[model samples]
Target: MKLPNTAHTSRPWRIHEIAHDFLLEDVWALPTPGGPDDFPRLVRQMTSGSNTNDSRAYTALFEIRWRLGKLFGWDRPDAGIVARVPSLRDRLPADLLAGPRGPVFSSVPFTSVYQTDDEWVAEMANRTVHALMHMSWVADEGGGYHGQMAVLVKPNGWFGRGYMAAIKPIRYLVVYPALLRMIGRTWELQAAG
Candidate 1:
């Protein structure tokens, strides 16, 4: 479900230290409830590609986005991370740099920034923006844990700002609801698998 931006900003996340300049674009409560130790399972399911793989609607949106990007050169390799903008990896502190940086994603263009038992972060960039997808395991008062996701972005310029504005309604109305349902269904299926 969509959450107030404060749901992420209120947390003492390590990401705050690295992505301080990025805007908190969206926060959502993921329905993947489980034990504290089950975070790895969540990570596994995500990296396995089940979320987008299983949902035709969700996949269609991405396909459309990619096709548009190709038409407009929005996703040109040089327009992405390590080229257009500096990587967040460059900002990592010594301890974070030394730790596991998480799994490489084969399903998407994002690169891992860090992974802990409770949190995982991946970053990506295109001509329009540099973005981060941060997943965190949050403890409920009753001892169960659920996943939370926050998106951070730094828009490239006037075009970037306009692009974000144009996509905001579509993102919130169509993309996110489809994504939430897809994630919930996949979370349950992973438990069965």
Candidate 2:
């Protein structure tokens, strides 16, 4: 479900240290309730599943975004990480760098940043923004654990700011709601099996 920005900001996440300049765009309470060890399963499901295909509208939205990026050179090589902006890895402390760099995504463009038993982070960048997707397994009051997802972004400049503004309504109104339902459905299937 869509959660308040404080849902993420109030947590003592290591991401806060590195993403000080980025905005906390969104946070959602994922429906994948399970034991603490189930985080890897969540990560694996996310990496391998095609959540955007859950609905025609979702697929169309993604296609339109991809086409726009291609046409406008928003995702061009020179516009990405280590090209236009320095990677968040550069800011990581020695301990985080020495640990296992998380899983490589199978379908998306994100690169692993770090992974621990309770938390995982991945990053991606384009002309519009340098973004981070953070997932954490948090203990629920009811005795089990559930997943939480937060998106953080540092917009490139004026174009970035404009692009973010234009997409805000669509993102919150359509994309995120569908995404939450998709995650719930997938988690049910995964748990059943």
Candidate 3:
């Protein structure tokens, strides 16, 4: 479910230190509820492209985005991580820097940054923005845990800001709801299995 930005801002996440200047574009409460030790499972399920089926709308939207990016040179390597923007990993402390960089993403264009016991960070950059995707395992009062996700982005300039504004509605309306359903189904299946 979509969450208030404060849901992320209130937490003392390591990402805050790495991407302090980025806007909190989104915060979401994932449906993957489990025990404290289950964070690795959640992260694995997420990075493994085969774990869940994507919504057709999302797939189509992604395809469209890619096409647009290609036509506009938005996804050139020179426009990515170290070329157009500094990598967030450059800001990591020694501990985080030496820790697991998480799994290789099977489908997305994101690069794994670092991972701790309860948190994982991945990043992607293009002409429109330098962005980070952060996931955390949050404990509930009942002693169980669930996942949370936050997206942080430093838009490149006026064009980037407009790009973000253009996509906001589709992201909130179609993309996120589809992801929520997909994750919920996968979590339920994991429990049943």
Model 2 vs. true fold: TM: 0.96
C-alpha TM-scores of all predictions = 0.95, 0.96, 0.95
Query: In model 2, which runs have C-alpha deviations exceeding 4 angstroms?
Result: 50-52
The number of the candidate with the highest TM-score is: 2
Q: Work out candidate 3's RMSD over C-alphas.
A: 1.3
Residue range 1-193, candidate 3, lDDT tens digits: 7889998899888888878898999999999889989999888888887456668998798889999999999999999999998889899999899889999999889999999999999999999999988999998767889999999999999999999999999999988888888888888888898
Question: Residue-wise lDDT of candidate 2 within 1-193, one digit each (tens)?
Answer: 8889998888888888888998989999999999978999888877775443467787799999999999999999898889988888999989889997887788778888887777888899999999999999988899999999999999888998998999999998888888888988888987887
lDDT per model vs. reference? 0.88, 0.87, 0.90
lDDT of 2 at 156: 85
Backbone clash tally (model 3): 0
Candidate 3, residue 184: Cα displacement in angstroms equals 1.8
Worst 10 residues of 2 by lDDT: 45-54
* Highest lDDT against the true fold, candidate: 3
C-alpha positional error of residue 28 in candidate 3 after TM-score superposition, expressed in Å: 0.6
lDDT, residue 103, candidate 3: 96
Q: What is the clash count of model 1?
A: 0
